[model samples]
Target: MSYQALYRAWRPQKFDDLVGQELVTKTLKNALMTKQTSHAYLFTGPRGTGKTSAAKIFSKAINCHFQKDGEPCNECDTCTSITAGRQNDVIEIDAASNNGVEEIRDIRDKVKYAPTECDYKIYIIDEVHMLSTGAFNALLKTLEEPPENVVFILATTEPHKIPATIISRTQRFDFRRIQPDTILQRMQYIVSQKQLKCEPAALKLIAKAAEGGMRDALSILDQVISFGNDEVTLDNALMVTGSVQNDELLQYLEQVTQKDTAKALEILHQILNDGKDAARFIEDLISFCRDLLLYQQMPEKVENDELNVVNDDFRNFSQKIKPEEIYQMIDLLNEQQENMRFTSHASIYLEVLTVKLATRQTTISPKTPQAAGEKLDPKDTIKVENLTRQVKQLQQQVEQLLQNQSNGQSVTATNSSRPKTTSYNKTQVRKTTAPAKVDLQQVYGVLSDATRTSLNELREIWDDLLNMLTVAQRAVMHVSSPVAASPDGVIVTFQFDFLCQRAQTDQPLKDTLENGLDRLIGHVPRLIFMPQEQWPQIRQEYLNGQKAQKHLTAGEDGQRTEQETPGDPKQPAPKDPVVDTALKLFGNEVVDIKND
Candidate 1:
């Protein structure tokens, strides 16, 4: 019974009384002064930003018997009657409650009559967006072409909801939220007028809690005043509003900075135990982090109680955190806040959030680096090793299959249609069945030729490698040498340096090389790949053969030596008739023979 909400008591009564909305006030005053006031005027803005107050004052100003300049005389009988809500000519209706077609039709009927005492009949409607479609249609005619003596003043927080047709017939004014300084000044004036005992810090806490809505700030003040009689303090204000004090927030931040999960969770649990809303706590944390971000970015703009919310200790803590990190923290807390709505276990959420934030933040103290390092176990190394082994195995399997496919051999499969006996000469069979069986060098040659033109072309044949081999076997394959087209077949080389690196002898690689070359060329190819370290020796042997004219080019030997051994390093090295013929047809530039 003793309660009087501060917002209602502090409602603005004059144009100058409006806060943080100079544009709206100036425009309305100009309109009133020029006698160019529209019959229907629409006011739109966020809640508690003087939209309704301005509408009411404008209505009174237009019909005041003792108007001065562009404002109403508050002492006049007409102004008094309007303010008291006793004037029939000045009507104030809540569209939220009276948003039916019948209500609008009733107003339409009443608009036909003229004002008896006041110069104009003023109708002020609040929350005009709540009107139903039919009700809006009913009001349309009167709004577009109202009676000469009547004026319709509509106010809405959401102008988008109102039909464009209604908006077009009216003059629209948008209101903005009150600034922090404006709210602070207004609050100070209210405290002085009521003779209330309050700290300036308490006023700032209330202003920040309101988030730019004057109504919310006033309501908070009203609640705080009630909690502590007529005297309001910071503690009492925070208590009533469930806003955790800055000191408590800083303590939580310190625990996190120290990576003290246990302490952090305990503190969070205590907050929950104290019956504070978990979502609201998360929201306040977001706001606290936002202020830290602003402090880091624009320290000069932050002042008043917003400055006191963060102390030197908190400033140091903020300095340790980057703006991006604080923003990420806010984002995470906001997500948790939304999730908490559906979760019955809000405490669990808060605890998890506390651990997450605390665990991720780097400590300000240099002494805790080792402890932080130990906190995250190096498990990724094991995963990386396993993945590398798997990839190697996969590459080996790709090579083996490619070899089998090139050989025209139906790779070891369970199908009954597979040949029971393979066709080959005794030496070829011996080479295939030998202990050092898989010819890796020949497989490399086949793959090299296959991939010579493009990588995409080779990828098509890569999958066929799987179909050509036994399930237990895999071969690490690669194109070791460039391709050269010859009348007999395409020549290639496969690098098997990995085999030597693994300490495996080159016999198996040679066998794989032979089989793969025979399949790719339609006939067995002369393949060459051995230990990389032995490559210089092999090249010397070839040079010795070419110089001596052995096994090939016996007729053209002397003639070829002069032309083949060009001084330019870029020219292809001279080789046997097989290589020379292949290079000539394939284009000499197309071939590259890497010794290793």
Candidate 2:
């Protein structure tokens, strides 16, 4: 074979050689030394975090002829073959490629045969999450209880995709992303062992860029070395990684958070012109903001470069910017990042994002919590004010009448002591029989801007809404069906007129219904009820009224675009139907309704 890649050549061959997985190594070594190993094991984590390497080492350690205290003697024939991937017993399978039921069945059938080259037959399946659902089902029985002396080791980056049944049957070991410092030390050792000249800053950059994956760090390092003709430098590392200098990223952030839009956009233009990825720049900015926020809160955590974003400039910038401002910038950046994913012109998004962040207001004054958080509809406000004013006027009139009676003490009071009936000509009182009529204003209010989606949203919560009420309240609601809904109100047609009248008059039912709906959907509705038989006529009348209103608007404007669009904008939406009704009722009607 040709020369192996750095990641391949530096693959951990022994449990002790594994980096940054002390707990995993310790447990595996204990199990092997005590001759107590699981029939199946799962190794899962981010890519290049020593999952497959750990699995391979475990396989060799378990089957090595010269195994000593769970350590594989690489000199032994069995261990050497496994290391070379030529061992018959240590079977490595790429589940991503051969993930089928038949392939798994073949393995199941072959497991019965004895090991030819080693004491135990070990199966290592890499990227095992790619196995089909049927393939996972096929391997379940064999995985849970394979033939004696057979072991299965499954490795994957995405453990969430794996079936719980598969994970439950195996002893799971979670591999963490290798820390940057740990990777830095490992890279330093690799460079020294190879006797190559490399910059400390370059190694640190590669380590941070690896993002907790040692294999990724090494691969980046390999590319940087190749680019620098076997000599690593910071410039080569930066070119390979496409990361802006720390000072430059810091400067860009400072300009943005300080509300310097032009300067920030200029910096972004230059950075993008240098071939830096827009998406990558977004991610880098988000990460930088994260570090800045963290450093601002915990300045002591910067020891040993623990945060991996520390420099004199970063620290000073962190001091200059408020943590909460960083929070807003990060939020804006993240939103733009999601938007960037759907578009090819990422530079446009980046520019827009820069301007938004730069101009974003940082000093947000906290809102004083209101006793009632929501504002009333304009119609509701007018009704309340009119009612209040009328009440004050009535109180003053009543006081005047009382004062006049007290001062006069007239003969009417003396005459009221005797019981008397006044017989006036043409004075007759008789009760008239009339059924309760559907309130047109109420139905029209709900159907004003009603939509199918709003009706569906109301109906979807009907059962839950009923469940929230008392037995009597539920009984009143059970006879009701939501026929139409706008954002602020719903028209519920009742099975009976009595129930409809009861729903309107019952104060308790009103509160629970509206309040429960508000709790469920975060908005209260002006619930209207009418007998079910009257709903069709009312809906037809409302639609006709809408058409008439549209016709009137067209006559006044000399244009009708209803054919082009099914519904014309001439029919103003019920921004707040209750408010409009109040305004109309209170003798103050605007000829044109502003679409606010």
Candidate 3:
């Protein structure tokens, strides 16, 4: 006999042998015992969860002549032939390959014939969802009115794609993913039966890596056994699964908590150099952080779950990190994991993520006394205490000054000639409240040439413009409106000063708005940001300055009129250009000349 894989050699031949599907096995066994089995059955679940195996077992049990306790007697000739795949009455079809109308039609035609050597003819169609529309239409009629002693078992990972008509006619059983504990127990049984030496921890790790799939667990176990020397250890399991050791993962996490970028990168590089997968490392790290968080919240639960053990080092490390920081780390690691899926440069992203984790600032309050004592030097502690004392003394002095003023007494110096200090004194804590700088000149220039028509056009489609921006950009511009507009630029005023400043400095946001406007309007005008409170004042200041300048100019013109002669032909017209242009364009009486 050729070498057989573990999954193939250990295929369950009876319903009772199936793992992690008690509900399904029990139901099927009861149905078989009562002789009330349905003609068409649909088994749907995730891959490697015993859907097909259960179907095969049920087929054998229903056909076996010497069935005991609703289980097929493997000793019988009928069960033997079916187990060996030599029975003509029981057929297994791969719907993925034969998903055509002709194949379904062939089944429809063959289903009418009576069983040649068995009591019933069973057809197991795996991946039935892969069938074409025409194939489903062809199978629907036969499934609805199958011949007596004929059974159809449809197995698929995705049941949603199956036609409702076909699903309505069949009895559906939904299977669930096997739990890790159940998988571990089964692995232990298999290892013990095969006389293989394996560590308990190794089995547990395999169970976790299986991710609720029995076949996958068995496959991983087979690979590990083949690689090891008759004895499987935790190291061998980790190596096969491309996972890091617990101690190494803890050390890497310690580096992150300590904010040691260099050491964390070195550890990451070593892991990658040793052929560990970057994605797996990230996944393990994320799991480790989650465990730490859970331990922090519920230590008793963590202690109970053998899979989530909290060692002395892990518990100690949990105290050093805060729950909030751990939450942030998990979120960031999850983002990196998402990014790793679409890019081949996973190592680069891993390195960058490592640095981010190492350098991430924690918002936790002051460190614990033990932590502070460990990191702070004695001399630095002394310096901090002295500075605190000096601050207290300064505060006391200010309070005393206020008390003296409230009591209507001046703080007089010891010497009579010296000056008295009072709270109202200008030299006492002078606060320079400088207003935020605004370029009134530029604002005035824009306002002077502002075009109302252009402003109205932009305002009409302002909502549309906002729609073109990203969600974040729209949020930032929500409190803003276009107050002034021109052919060259537009002035947008914000209700809050901070938003005005943000809009002024956010170049990318400005660029996005400009691009959006360019698409909406024919031209992209420059955006000018100003606070609503400051806009009116700046405009008024500009107008008042203009008026003052005009008044001064008119006064100078009046003074010049008194000095200039009416018709002075011999005075060289005072040699003034303004006086000469005034005499040339208008008559001397109507012209007002200014002279220096």
Candidate 4:
């Protein structure tokens, strides 16, 4: 009387009629033939995998008056009524809506009664996971011990949510998503059966877009047929589904591959202004890129259906894009899609994404432009000032290591062998008479002549100020260690915090420190910053200067003192003068030192 949709019209009427699931059908058929069907059944799988349809077929097969070889006799009144959904014995329920405990109780109450007309009363519950916990508990008993004449079939897309108790009593059948080739063959058969006017490429596109869902493919085909006056055409199908035309997407992709940002944005704007949903555009773009990748990796694996529907130009374009580039493009589109969902300014987000895509070169390109490269090189924007700052850090380390060595700290083999690239020496010198303390003023004089104009300007006032400090303070100021240098001046960092704190105590003291540093090196120290915690350790070291003076006296004698603490000792020493001094200075604290 009325035209039926393709999905409804082509609904599988028999187990044999179901496509891409012969194993399931054969299993059920064998069970029916031997009267080995379970009292309860669970069907689980993705959408359009025929779980519900298989349940119906099973019901009809068991109830058919003239059943033969485990198949239903369509001519029988029982089979006819079940097929038309008019049979009282075969009941279908949508568990999603009637998932309360009360509904389950009602089913439980009725489950005990025998079938009125058919041999078995079959109950099919779809989306069974929607059942409440209480409902599942109620269904458990009936499922476990139902009447001999009753059968229960529960179906759900998500099987993991089903209670294990309920699952234990049932024969679970897992349905699989139909393969593309399987769906394509079926679509071709359907078109032939109906004598429908369609292009081969159109059918393949429908199959691929269905994504392993037969119902989806049929639904899309139905829309296309309706829009094309009973003839399902490629153009109508693309328009109905709002899929991007291959050529248009190819043009946008070419611009991106070439890193033409302006052209890409212009094309995207044109598409958006034409009323296409940016979100949908992103979705289609992802699909287009995925197809390109699939074709590139395994050309023989590509299904010929709708892919064949694409014009020659689009096919050529798809070939032009490499698999890696297609992967990157898909990733970008997916990111854009996610941003669009929550963004208040979706259009702007889409615009920015398109511009970014256009500015990205092909993934496999050997030579990348500076602005549009995947990975930026650090050398691209080298700053000489940073190198100078790093060099200063190296100098500080050398000064600190030299101090520790003179104090008899253990020298790590790794550290002793480490190389230096600058003018500084990497050689390990045996302790010599703490080399006649270098004269800070004389050092500045030599530096003044050897240094460049920039260094000379910074050291100008520094040499004059150093002439005033005591020899001890001057010795503490060995090699003005480097700090963060600037364009106009350089930073002189002190080796220890005591030096910095002492320099900061008086205005002239600070000026003396800066001028001496500048005079010896090339830059006046600007800001002095130290690791905050290291400052306290440096202060403690200063307070312990008396110990170093004693150690020097002890070293000058023939009596040997331990250079560093051993990792483990078998016996504790009664007490030594040097050990007592260490205990006084450190007060039971552990000080890590290295030695051979």
Candidate 5:
């Protein structure tokens, strides 16, 4: 006989021999015993979860002549022949290769024939979703109305791709992934049966690496056994799986918690140098943080033996770190993971993430009143006293100014000379009058030359621009709208005055918006923020000024036309003398014509 892999050699031949599918096995066994088995069945779940094994076991058990209480007697000729794949009545098809309509039609044509040597003719189609639409349509009729003594078993990992009509006609059984503990127990039994010595932790590690797949667990165990001589140890298992030891991961986490950036980065470099995958390392770190958070919240709920770290060390570390810090760390790591997916320089990202984790500040707990008498740091105390004296001096200056206002006199220091006093008053007067007037001429000029075509283009992609921002930035700008656009800048008006102020003061938000816009569009125009309440008034005033100048020019042109053609009797109406006189004295165009 040729050498066989562990998964193939240890394939389950009976329903009772299969592990971690009790619900499916028990239900099928009862159905067989009652002689109420359906003609067609659908088994769906994750890979290596005993779907195919259960299908084969059920096929043999239903046809065995010496079957008792839904259990197959493997000693019988029928059972043995079926188990050895020599039976003509039982067939296994890989749909991934034979998923054409002609193949399905061939099966449909063969279903009419009676079984050659068994009670029923069984067909097991794995990966049934790979069948084409036409093939599915061809099989639909046969599945809905199958010949007697004929059984169809369809298995797939993705049931959603299968047609609803096909699923409705068959009895469906959903298989679940095997638990780690269950996988471990099965491995221990296999080791004992094969007369192999293995450490319990070694089996547990293999089980964890298998990720709820029994076939994967067995394959890993088989490789580990081949690598070691007699006994399988935890270190050997870790080596075969290319996984880091728990101690190494724990030390790295310790450096991060202690805020030691240099050591944390060194550990990260070493892990990568040892050929560990950067993405996988991040995944394991996230799982470790989750475990710590769980253990911190409920110690009794955590299985200490299953944990990768020593229980004592885990407990001590949990005490040193708070729950909120762990949450923030997880969030930051997840964000970094998302960012790393789009970049080729994953090592650089991982290094940067390590430093960020190490440098993040831990939140301080509030101290109670009883602990207030503890000695404070001298530097902090000195800074606090200096700030207090400056605050007092400012308060005194404010009070003196208020007193001088009540007495109707300017505030002047008694010790200051007359020249210094005059200089102070003049400076204060200039500060008061600085912002009372604004020259709108420059703004009007910019608006007149603004390109509406560019503004329209921006309006079309405004939503896309907002979508590119982070969630926090989006929330801050949600109430704002782009009201006016210019070639050099865009004027965004906010519904609330405070929101406008916030948008103006937030430099980082402005930079992010600019960068995002530059990526979407070719250029990043300047953003001008104003409150919505003020926008209409400013726009209306500018438009009215423009209209008045047009009307004045029109009046002058009409007068000239009348003088040029004197034969026409029509003449222009006279303007108000007072308005004309005011316009002449001020040397400005008349903005309004009033009636007396």
Candidate 6:
């Protein structure tokens, strides 16, 4: 006999044999015994949870003459034939290969016929989610209304990919992933049956590696058995799965918890060099942290089957780490795992993650009166006090400035009310008088490169950008409009002079604007804020300059024509007052004078 894979040899033969999905198995068994089964059934779940096995078992039990309690006797001729797959009526289809419209049409064509050997004709379509859109449409009618004696069973790992129309027409059963303990017990039974020598820890390692798949667990176990020459060991299981051992995971976690970045990194380097996968290592760490959290939170209620880490060392180590710290570790490791997908250099991300985990301080649970059990570190408390003081200073400055403005005095912030930060020059006065005159040179420079497309793009995200700004900045920006936008800068015309001047000298506002624009548009632009009162004058100046330049150009062209043609010899060109004077001084040989 040819050697068969463990997954195939130890395939579940009955609904009772299915692992970790009592709800699905019990429902199917009830449906079978009552003979109230739907014509079409949809089995959706992760792989290797016995969807196909359950479908096969249903087919045999429905046809078995000696069936009892919805279970097939497996001794009768029809049951034996179906079990051996010799029953012509029970067909198993792999939808991954035969996922064309034509294939579905073929099934549709044959479904109307009566069964040749059994009471019912069965079609089990595996990986049914892989079927083409056209094929799903083709199967829609037959699946919803198959012949009285025909049954359709569709199984898929990804139900989301299956069409809703197809899903709506069938009785759906979602198979869940088999638990590690369930997988562990099954493996133990198989090993004892085969008289194989295997360590319990080795079986546990294989169970965790399976990630809730029975067939995966068996396959891994088979490889480990072969590697150890039919005697499975913990070392062989670890090597086969490319997973780091629990001790290494523990060592790494301890180092990180103790704030030893160098030691943690060194241990990680050794693990990766020993051929342990970086992704798998990260998963192990995440799992370890999760188990530690569970145990710490509910030591008495923690189930033996719920955790992968069940050791004296882990329990003692759990005492050294806080729940908040574990939460942070999980978050960091999960983020690094996401980062690993985009780059091939997993070690770099791991190293970065190590530094972050080791350097992060434990969250402090303060005993303050404001909020009991809330976390507030001393640094955060200091920050809050500083911010409160600054806010008070800003309020005083605003009140003083408003009072001065009402009395028609110069705008100024009292020295006592001024902010400690020198980066912001709130008290600096512009040489130009109060209505906040625009900088003509800057405005003209912006207009030179301004584009309608750039302005429109700027307008699209104006409201969102305002929301992203600080409260004080948003108040100023809300009354402003982005009038002109170039590749390198934006001109914001404000409705008020104080807001404009305030925005001009506010370094934090500038930083916030640049950061927000960079985040939203991928380009940081120089911001120029001006009052709306100055916009008309600046716009008029720009328009007049453009018109004058055009007129001068036209006048020069006319003079060139006069110099070239002698002016039709009948009519003399009119003289311009400005051009005539310039020509009198520079000579008529230079250009003929023309009036516009």
Q: What TM-score goes with each of the models?
A: 0.59, 0.62, 0.60, 0.58, 0.60, 0.62
Per-residue lDDT tens digits for candidate 4, residues 1-596, read 99888888899988888988888999999999998999989999999989999999999999886778888988889888998999999999999999998999999998888888999999999999999866775676678889999999999999988755577789999889998778888888888999989977677667767878899988988888888987978777666666666677888888888888888888888877766666667877787777677766665555464344355666687767677777777778888887788777778988788777776656565565655666655774466567887788778777766766667564343354355333222233313212222233332333222224433354564455556465765765553443223333343546555555554454534544543453355444443433233435443453356456666777899666565455458755334443453343343446433233
Q: Pairs clashing in candidate 6?
A: none
lDDT string, candidate 3, 1-596, tens digits: 99889899988888878999999999999999999999999999998999999988888899888898899998788888988899999999999999998999899988999999999999999999999866876786689889989999999999988866578889999999999999999989999999999999898888888888999999999999988976779888988998887789999988988889999999999999988888889878887888888888898888897775568998899888888888889989999999999999999999999999998877766777687676677998999999998788667667777777677666654445434554454333233423335666566666656656777788998999888676787877889898777677778888877677777777667756765675578667767788788777765565567556655776888754334655766655445433342343233665665544
Off by over 4 Å in 1: 1-3, 303-309, 342-345, 360-596
Q: Candidate 2 — which pairs collide?
A: 379-579
Instruction: Give the Cα error of residue 439 in candidate 6, in Å.
Output: 49
Clashing pairs in 4: 204-305, 204-306, 205-306, 410-594, 410-595, 455-522, 459-518, 459-519, 462-515, 462-516
Q: Candidate 1, residues 1-596: lDDT per residue as tens digits?
A: 58557887778778988888999888888888899888999999888888878877887899886778788888888888878779888889999999998999999998999898899998999999999866876777689899888899899998978866678889998888887768888999999999999988888878877877888888888888888988989888767777777677878977876789999888888877776777668878887787788778877665444425556876787788776567667777877888898888888898889988887743343555466665534686688787998788667655655676567554453345433334334346545542322354453334334322433333344445433333322344443443332232333324444533332344344443434333333333344334444444433444455445544455455443334435778876655554553343344566875441
Error of 3 at 583 (Å): 98
Model 2 — TM-score against the truth?
0.62
Better of 3 and 4 by TM-score: 3
Q: What lDDT does each candidate get?
A: 0.70, 0.80, 0.82, 0.71, 0.80, 0.82
lDDT of 5 by residue, 25-74 (tens): 89999999999999999999999999898888888999998898898998
Model 5 scores worst on lDDT over the 10 consecutive residues at 415-424
- Candidate 3 vs candidate 6: the TM-score winner is 6
Model 2, 1-596: lDDT tens per residue? 79778998888888877999999999999999998999999999999889988888888888876788788988888878888889888889999999998999899999999999788999999999999866876787789889888999999989988866688889999999888889999999999999999889889888888999988998998898889999999988878888777777888988887789999999999998887777778777887787777777786776456437576777777777776787788889889988988898988998898889887877765663365486768998899898998788666655654565556532222234333333222112111323356678867776666666777788898999899787878887887888778888888888777778787788657756765675578767787777897878876676667656766777799775344433666874434343443333222433454433
Q: lDDT for model 6, on a 0 to 1 scale? A: 0.82
